[model samples]
Target: MDALDASVPAISPSRPFRASVVTFRALVGSGFRRYATYRQATVAGTFTNIVFGFLRCYVLLAVAAGTAGAMAGGYDARQLATFVWVGQGLLNVVGIWGWADLSERIRTGDIVADLVRPVSPVTAYLAADLGRGAHALLTRVAPPVLVGALFFPMATPSRWQTVPLFAASVLLAVVGSFGCRYLVNATAYWLADARGPLAFWTLGSGVLAGLYFPLRLLPDWLAVTLWVATPLPGLLQTPLDVLIERDPPALQAGLVALQAVWAVIMLALAGWVQRRAERKLVVQGG
Candidate 1:
């Protein structure tokens, strides 16, 4: 028998590309279009975000009020309101939960096709996530923020620079969040079902990421540890704090830098794990 063509890379039994900018953009556009097609879901989700925004706002304000309107957890009433509403908006932007498509594909053995594709799964999925984030920014984010701004004393960024800084942080959060979800879904390779990990991630991510409250409210040692050891704060707290100008310029810059670092690290880890999973497929004749 002819030796397997030396030029062709060996196909791993169970597997899974760097997509270029043009390809990446197309992937993103496709993702955006897919989510956009769900008009009713978009509306329902937006309404839900708005409702939660109000609920969280009132609870946080009450906390501030009980402290005689003094700054609690470094947040005055106005800043606290901004945190709640903006955080509600960011829920869709970062998409802290609700990703299971990859796991389903793996369980169905459909991911083998993905392995044959030219595009890297990481880049493709991330591009699509970017597109999804773009859609959320336009539809889900603006509404709740506008509603809160209209009715509440929300804090505005003290410096114009904070606006752009916050935007950068938000973008990094999206990338980092995708990396996290990708890893969680990859568990399907070994577990046959990713539900357990997905459920646990959903519950823990919200609190750890500061969706329900500010990280600063936690004890100093705990908050600092979370900030340094995990990407959770970058998912919401960093961006919102930057938006409200809660930190000095230097610290704000440091926060965004930290987010960038986490984004890179998480993506790299995902890529490495994907490669190892592919190797397992080869060894198992998957």
Candidate 2:
């Protein structure tokens, strides 16, 4: 499994997790070293994001210019710039694309190998994903932000709590994202392939998560609906909003709270879904 399997579970004894703390640490290190070998691809992706960042920033600034009082969707010019640039930085950190390992394994029946392992596939994959997110933050998130800062005015957090809050939000985002992706990939266990679901996921996730544009640009009712009802917004929008201090301090904390809730829900659902699939397979054995 190429680390993106999101299918590998850590382990559990009486709970959803079973892997020892030391084994989980080794798995995380293995995941980190696995992706670190892709040096050139990381550079290429960074360059692509930078190019898109320029285009996105200019277009958003134009929209802001035409808005009443230059408040483009509850954001000032500086915040919009920060939103674009920092968003570009976080794009990979939350990993919105290029994860098919789990589905591919299921389709090939290699998941049978995973099933017999000592650890739970879900927890194992989550630890690996954390390693991947850490690598992304170290290598993929900086260049575009630096490039954006050189060319545009990016918002800096005015609150002392913003930095810590933003960090917490990001950790939740990665955890939530892994669960969401795992669910999408797990569809292969039933559907023979995950392409159909993955297509729908790829189609909606970026837009709904506020990657191409802020959800706030939508009508308040719709934006709030997405925020409260779906996990999409928490993946990217919550952290970016926290980092830019878009909401008041209390509201900022509230958003992170929401992210935490969604992360827990997604993980619970993933564990449930995987258990269901396993139960079916075992019952069919004659």
Candidate 3:
């Protein structure tokens, strides 16, 4: 062998910097393109969301109208309508369900290939999810809002700060949702079949994350408890609340801060869990 070949060192798959930012960006772009290829599914899902948005908006409107001029769950009719429609948009943006990629790979033992790749699984998956979120933001978020605006009175943010704040909250929601799904898929490391956990996650995330209804509609204590204890509200409630200016300036900023904190925490936890899982798999000759 030549001196150049002799001097070159082998690269390990898990080298800390194996996956660079460019690689992540490419992964995200590819992920976006992958979903874009599913044109029919996107069209169908968007239609379903709009249909559900109408049903949910009507229900919330009825609840608000029945309040006899009192703010039901701190929302008037217009705000409630905004909540329903924005939530329909966010439902796809946050991607509360239909994420079985990692678990499916694990079930088929293809996770071994992923584990050996020169990339962090958590980050690679996260980049792809962000891509998916971007696609959803384009294809799914706007149609419902536009359609609802035509049919119903929609609430607008009071302060200009709320616009940027809502955007940040939405981005963090995507991150936090990815973390939650990552941890859920990571369970495949332990369980032979991850479908059960994925099912459980799908069922609970919608209600707990306030996709079904505004968290404020629940009793004060329950709402506060969930907010303090779980990242669920940060996934959907925070962004919607910010968009409608449900809280004062200080509280709105605080809510976004909390979402950021949770996103970091959950992502860190996912990375740690994945590392441990990889080590365990290696020891078992996986």
Candidate 4:
């Protein structure tokens, strides 16, 4: 009996991972609930995006109208209108700005509590952010799209595969965007105040991710370079382009594939940075 008791494993090898997944899922739910509390903010944000959608759509439509082929940046009038509406809808979902949670915690010295939690801070925050993004899709993304469809000729998906592909792209975009924001927020781990890096990330992500206009308007080489070299384009531009069918079905798949790769890379980078910060904190605490 004593030998049998000694030989038995207290916890299986997969137990920790399983437990982590459970915790992550629960945290995701918690995140959803947390964001759901911001009812007023959600409505205001959706309204703001709708307002901007109109302004941007009008300007882009005018540009396309004046161009030689009734196209600007390879987008026809309807396509450009769709782009504007979708971009506006995604503005909150993809979280281009207004994320400073980590920085605020670090500044307040409250982040130490996160370290003591069972789940890794990265996983916990990411799960929560996924929930927040999910909430945004419902509360923020839909309204502007409905409003746009009522007012403008939004382009329909050209291919059956486009719907699924765009859905995948948006998921990847949300994850990749969270990773980017996570890293930007993690800067507070070292800097104590992450304003400079956060500001730069905020501004650059908006412009480079095709928030103001489609990236295809740039020179082909520059557009390709940005798409291949930076995660920023994958965060917003790839998803938007995929939705609007800027390229053929094969090319659209390729773009979403690229987004998956960046999503992996960004998450890996965030994890690495988190580990480094944890080790440093331990050393300091010791």
| Top lDDT prediction, candidate number | 2
- In angstroms, how far off is 97's CA in candidate 4? 1.0
Candidate 4: worst-modelled 10 consecutive residues by lDDT: 4-13
Q: What TM-score, over all chains together, does every model reach?
A: 0.91, 0.91, 0.91, 0.92
Positional deviation of 246 in candidate 4, in angstroms?
1.0
How many pairs of residues in model 4 come into backbone collision?
0
Task: State, as a TM-score between 0 and 1, how close model 2 is to the true structure.
Answer: 0.91
Worst 10 residues of 2 by lDDT: 10-19
For every candidate in turn, the CA RMSD to the true structure comes to 7.6, 5.2, 5.6, 6.1
lDDT of 2: 0.89
Q: Put down candidate 2 lDDT per residue, 1-286, tens digits, no spaces.
A: 5778454554556553344875687677777777799999999999999999999999999999998899888999999999998899898988877788888988877788878888899988888888888899999889999999999988888899999999999999999999999999999878868999999999899999999899999999999899899999999999999998889999999989999999999999999999999887532112
Residue 23 in candidate 4, Cα distance off native in Å: 1.6
lDDT of each: 0.87, 0.89, 0.88, 0.87
lDDT of 1: 0.87
Which ranges in model 4 have alpha carbons more than 4 Å from their true place? 1-18, 282-286
Report the backbone clash tally of model 3.
0
Can you write out model 3's per-residue Cα lDDT over 135-192, one digit (the tens) per residue? 9999998999999999999888779898889889999999999999889987888885
lDDT of 4 by residue, 187-211 (tens): 8889878999999998899899999
